[model samples]
Target chain A: EAGVAQSPRYKIIEKRQSVAFWCNPISGHATLYWYQQILGQGPKLLIQFQNNGVVDDSQLPKDRFSAERLKGVDSTLKIQPAKLEDSAVYLCASSLGQRVFTDTQYFGPGTRLTVL
Target chain B: GQQVMQIPQYQHVQEGEDFTTYCNSSTTLSNIQWYKQRPGGHPVFLIQLVKSGEVKKQKRLTFQFGEAKKNSSLHITATQTTDVGTYFCAGADTNAGKSTFGDGTTLTVKP
Candidate 1:
C-alpha cells in the first residue's frame, strides 16, 4: 500500500506572506490529521478530520490558519500572514479511525516551512 | 488540557549500552503509543499500549505502560548506530477525545 503523500517537501516564505501545503492520505484511511512540529518540540495537533467532517481543531489558529479535507481523501492546510514562529515542519497523518489505541498512523514526509 | 512529557531529552551511549526514556502524563491516559523519527524524517508509529501495566517488546526495544496509566517507558538494549533517532510518546485520553505527544527523547549511539 502507498503511504501518505505530501507536496512541496520544503517551502520558504517571507513573514506576512501566505503559504499552503497539501496532503494526500493513504487510500481507505478514514481519519486525517495535520500537525505542526517546531524544532526540538513534539508535534502539535492543528486539526483533525474524520471522513470530511472536522473532529477537532481546538489548537488551530483560526485567525491565521485553516485546513480542509474536501471529499475526505485529501487535505490542504493554509497559513496567511505567516509569522517567523510559524516556521516549522507540517506533518500529515492518517489512520483507519479514531481508535488511536488500536489504529496505527501513517505519516507523510512532511513539508518543512521556513518563514523568514 | 492534557500534557505528555518525556524525560532525558537527549541521551548518548556506547553501542553496547542500554538506554531508556520515560513519558509521563498530567492525566490518566486511555492508551499510549510510541513513535520513532530519524533526523530530517517524520515520525513512524512504533507501538501502542492499552491495558494497564502492559509490556511489549520489539527486537531490542521494550515498551511498558504504567499501572496507573499516567506513565510509560521505552528501553533499548545494546544500542546500535541504527538506533539513533528521537523517540516520542503520544498519550490518548478518551475523555479528551484527543492525543498529546511528548517533546521526544533523542538518542545517539557511539560506536
Candidate 2:
C-alpha cells in the first residue's frame, strides 16, 4: 500500500503572492484533512473532507484560503495573497473514516511554505 | 471549541533516562490518541486509548488513559537519540469523533 503523497516538499513565496499545495491520499481512505503547523506549534486543522463533501471547515480562513477535493481522492489547498505568518508546514493526512479512535491516520512529508 | 493541553512543553533527557508527558482536557473525552513527529517530519499515529485507565505499551513507549477519561500520559523509557521528536496527544470526544490536538511536547535526547 502506498502512503499519503504531497507535492512540492518546500515552497518559498513573498507576501501577497498566491500559493497552492496538492495531496494524494492513501487508497481506500474516505477522509482527508489539511492542517497548518507553525514553528514550535501543533498542527491546526484547516479543513476536513469526507468523500467529496466537506465535513468541517469552520477554522479555515475563507477570506484567503480555499480547498477542494473534487473527486474525493486528491485535494488541493490554496492561499491567495499569503502572509508572513502563513509560513509553516502544510500537512495532509487521511484515514479510513471519521472514527479516528478506531482508524489510523497516515501523513505525508508536508509542504513547508516560507513566505518572505 | 475544546481546550486540550499538554504539560512539560519541552524536555531534555540523557541517554538511558526516562521521560513522560501529560495531556489534559477540560471536557471528558471518549478516546485519546498519541502521535510522534520527528524533526522536520509530520505527525505519525502512535496509538489510541478508548477504555478508561487503559494502558498500552510499544517497545519503550508506554501510553496511559486517565481514570477520568479527560487526561492521558505517555512515558518513554531509557531514551535514545532515535526518540527525539515532538509528541502530541489528541482527544476524540463523544461528539463526532473530531479531535483537538494538544500542543506537542518536544523531547531532546543528549547522546
Residues A67-116, model 2: lDDT tens digits: 99988899999999899999999999999985645677789999999999
DockQ of 2: 0.74
lDDT of 2 by residue, B1-111 (tens): 688999999999999999999999988999888999999888999999999999999999999999999999999999999999999988877675568889999999999
Candidate 1: list runs displaced more than 4 Å. A98-101
lDDT of 1 by residue, A1-116 (tens): 99999988999999999999999999999999999999999999999899999999999999999999999999999999899999999999999985644688889999999999
Most accurate candidate by TM-score = 1
**DockQ score for candidate 1:** 0.83
- lDDT of the candidates, in the order given: 0.95, 0.92
Q: Quick one: best lDDT, which candidate?
A: 1
Off by over 4 Å in 2: A98-101
Task: Please tell me the TM-score of chain B in candidate 2 relative to the true structure's chain B.
Answer: 0.96
